[model samples]
Target: MTGETAPVAARDEADPVAVIEVQAAVLTRNFELLRRRSGFDSQLDRAGYLLLLALDSLGPSDIGTLAAALGLDPSTVGRQVAAAEGKGLVTRNPDPQDRRRSVVTASPDGLARMAELSVARQRRTTKMLAGWSVEDLAQLARMFTRYNEEVAHHYFTGIDQVGCAAPHDQPKHSTAEDDS
Candidate 1:
């Protein structure tokens, strides 16, 4: 029964809050499935994932720039980079313009692996929204994206200002937190 689908279970009687809670649980379970399939958890711990994500979005960046982008200390990001390099997921090379400075790049293999994982992640998302119409899905995406951006800008910036700097740019995006 490796590929067998599970039977659908009925939901209990629910108030609005209870319905929301059940939806949250279902979303969380779907997310966990995506993570497991992606193998991101096994490949890179939280720090490594952040580093890879930063590199993927920003391209080759100096340690200081990466640290600033992540709102983390340079030394901490340096250590994370070292770990990524050791796994052949990233490489740190001397900046051509400034030989003293270094730029980090995600390795080709790393990019390929990430792409595969991304596809698997997308499949999970599609399954989650299977019943939604295209317009509804589009609207949901827009609203969620805007909400996330606002929360990150407001809360994360405030945390940084108050000196609660973490190595990751934003805390891991949890379904519960996002829904809340």
Candidate 2:
């Protein structure tokens, strides 16, 4: 039954949310399938990857600051930092301003690993979307960004996470009058 389509229940054609839900489910599987097919693997797990991204964006920070920016529990961040440290993916130093506190940063090895992962992912995506128009990709990016923001807004309040520092920006389109 490989690549067999599931039987979908007939729902209201006008129900956009229902359609979105169905498509979202398909997208989750699509990513899994694509990743497997692409053979792109990473040593960094999702949490560690995100933690590293936050560090890259904000620079060295104490656990509390990192947790606050990422909207994660400080205890959870502490454990993640510990695990990352064990893997030599991050380094912790006593804060110069306050020796009692530790500042955590992604190690050089971690940054190199992440860079490799990112380039592999980008290559995979580019190949997957080889024929897509730039406008089409831009539209999808905008929609995805909006969807992520909405989901975050619903689940978390006052989150100031990396890659979401500001509201999504769009290029201004020129009208016919503007061409004059």
Candidate 3:
């Protein structure tokens, strides 16, 4: 007897939201896996991790500047920084040029911890790319870099607003198509 095939639903031409949602979910899961493998998730929550990254990248920065860069409230940034300070991972000091401002910097211990985390992250990333050829990896990286740049540009240009939206706040744009 011939086997019968199951019916499959046709793709919706108008919906893109589902596409974005799925992509976001996949990226989130990948990041979670990476963080877990690197022991980052166990050591710090997302905010704290971000704080560490900012300190690493920007060197010492005043609380206000850090808060702005992180898109977090000043109080929230302060709390996270305080926690990092308490762990002896960072130091808070009065800004040399501005007595009214305080800057946060990663301490020696923090840098060492970050180095360990970085190595773990790199190892995981390398494993994930192991199946890809160098050319393929380079192409993939280029696409990702371009996408990131475009997205950041859109956000910074005020074309893609960033704020909490109620269910009613979503634009009435068609969600039936997957742009990808």
Query: How big is the positional error of residue 63 in model 3, measured in Å on the Cα after superposition?
Result: 1.2
- CA lDDT of every candidate: 0.70, 0.75, 0.66
Question: For residue 157, what is the lDDT in candidate 3?
Answer: 23
lDDT of 2 at 170: 28
Candidate with the greatest TM-score versus the true structure: 2
lDDT of 1 by residue, 1-180 (tens): 798556434365446656655665676786777677666777556577677777777788999878766667799999999988898989989999999999899998777766666666678779977999999998987766665454555445212221223344544445766655
TM-score of each: 0.61, 0.78, 0.66
The list of candidate 2 runs beyond 4 A from truth reads 1-10, 35-42, 158-180
lDDT winner, 1 or 3: 1
Q: After superposition, how far is residue 13 of candidate 1 from its true place, in Å?
A: 15
Candidate 3: C-alpha lDDT = 0.66
For candidate 2, the 10 contiguous residues with the lowest summed lDDT are 163-172
Pairs with backbone N, CA or C atoms under 3 Å apart (clashes), candidate 1 = none
User: Model 3, which residues run further than 4 Å from truth?
Assistant: 1-20, 33-38, 154-180
- Give, for candidate 3, the lowest lDDT window spanning 10 residues: 157-166
Kindly provide the TM-score of model 3 when superposed on the true structure, using C-alpha atoms: 0.66
